[model samples]
Target: MARQHPEEPTLVELTIEEVKAMGKQGIDHPSTRPVITGGVVGAIAGAVLPVVTWPVGLFAGAAIALYTRVKR
Candidate 1:
């Protein structure tokens, strides 16, 4: 079995810390840009698609981006 690094944080811990940082820092947080980019891309996709609304697409995109960022 592979041993985990003592200094490395677990996924849950990293996610919690990232969430806290986002809440405290708002747009200034490091994860902001990727999230915003994802939102924009989603918005554009939504606009292009007749079934989905821009607002919903924007939210979904941002959430996906945030998840990816946290995992990283």
Candidate 2:
């Protein structure tokens, strides 16, 4: 019989924490500067593009945010 370590976190919990940490790291990255750069870019794009179609601007904002996080 195998023993289950009571003090150990389950695989799922560890995976969740890892994912959360990755998100935090992405947000904290220097290139994006999520609060100032990403947010401002996204907001501006969203405001400008929405004139054509409401959802389009929202999608553009989301893409900008993603690009900011992924950009070097």
Candidate 3:
């Protein structure tokens, strides 16, 4: 008869730890895509709307995207 091996338990990281890890990774992190996409979308919107500048829109979009990613 074949012997069965027990499965190991998985470790879950806290939200703060995950954020710290991502921060260490910086722009090279997986979250870069969403941030960049948000920046682009914001820039486009800013261009369309005369009130907001492209740079301001870009920063706001990136911040929002990063917040959402970290919260997840």
In model 1, where do residues sit more than 4 Å from their true spots? Answer: 1-16
TM-score of 3: 0.61
Off by over 4 Å in 3: 1-28
1-72 per-residue lDDT for model 1 (tens digits): 999867888888887888798889998999988889999999988889999999989988988898899876
Q: Give a tens-digit lDDT track for model 3, residues 1-72.
A: 999998643223344554576689977878877888988888877778899998888888876776677666
Q: By TM-score, rank the candidates, best first.
A: 1, 3, 2
lDDT of 2 by residue, 1-72 (tens): 999867877555654554466578775654334434445555666667645453555556554554545442
> TM-score of each candidate?
0.70, 0.32, 0.61
Better of 2 and 3 by TM-score: 3
TM-score for predicted model 1 compared with the true structure: 0.70
Q: In terms of TM-score, how similar is model 2 to the real structure?
A: 0.32
Highest TM-score: which candidate? 1
The 10-residue segment with the lowest total lDDT in model 1:
4-13
Error of 3 at 71 (Å): 0.8
Which residue runs of candidate 2 sit more than 4 Å off their true CA positions? 1-50
Q: How many residue pairs in model 3 have overlapping backbones? A: 0
